[model samples]
Target: MKDKKSAKLNLQHKQHQNGHLSPSTFAKLLDLEASWDKDQLGDVLHWIRQIVALICGLLWGAVPLVGGIWLVAFLLISSGIVYGYYAIILKVDEEEFGGHGSLLQEGLFASVTLFLLAWTLVYSLAHF
Candidate 1:
């Protein structure tokens, strides 16, 4: 019985370790948005953060022109970070926009995917 319990506990711990953030931790992150009053500036800031990943996609396209590979790399990493911040914004959007949190997540995912794709295209096109 003891061994079985230990094994079960270990498995549960492993599952959480594998990128499985708990709702409490995720909810704590979302708390940041709660401080903002549902108003114009708060909405503006939310939009800006949500668009960071999209901005990275645009930045990656310009990398080839000026040899801004480092800059582009920085933008890509920053975009990922901003997407995380936007996740918090999304939670707030749930309250403000009637549970449309996935919209921001989708935008971030799409923008990150396109950013990487654009970078890959630039490399292949320039080389080939």
Candidate 2:
């Protein structure tokens, strides 16, 4: 059993090295256990926030969400995900990235811009 497991792992590693990861192996690669530099981590957080913004904008527009509540919700969800990823999942030191404020603020403005753009576009096309 141990040998078989080791062989399977080796095969998976080889497959990954060849740039052909299965879904499960790909998911494992996203687990965030590898060491990351400050810039790389910040970039990851920025992209993650951007993706979250796009999805939330789409959903909000689809649901016809309007007013301040939706904006508040978007802020909460986007910040919450970034917090959870760094603080909980990655377990990185907040001070290294210049505290929670700086880390959370990464890509915030850009993501908000993206979110507003997507929301208005979707809402206008769908509702009006």
- Please report the candidate that would top TM-score against the real structure: 2
Off by over 4 Å in 2: 1-32
lDDT of each structure? 0.50, 0.84
Candidate 1: tens digits of C-alpha lDDT, residues 1-128: 99999999999976764433434444544465434333322343334444564455455555553455654664556545544554545444444533334333334444546556665666567655
TM-score, cand. 1 vs. native: 0.33
Query: Candidate 2 residues 11-72, lDDT tens each?
Result: 98766645232355435435766665566677678878999999999988888999988998
Number of colliding residue pairs in each model: 0, 0
Per-prediction TM-score to the true structure, in the order listed: 0.33, 0.75
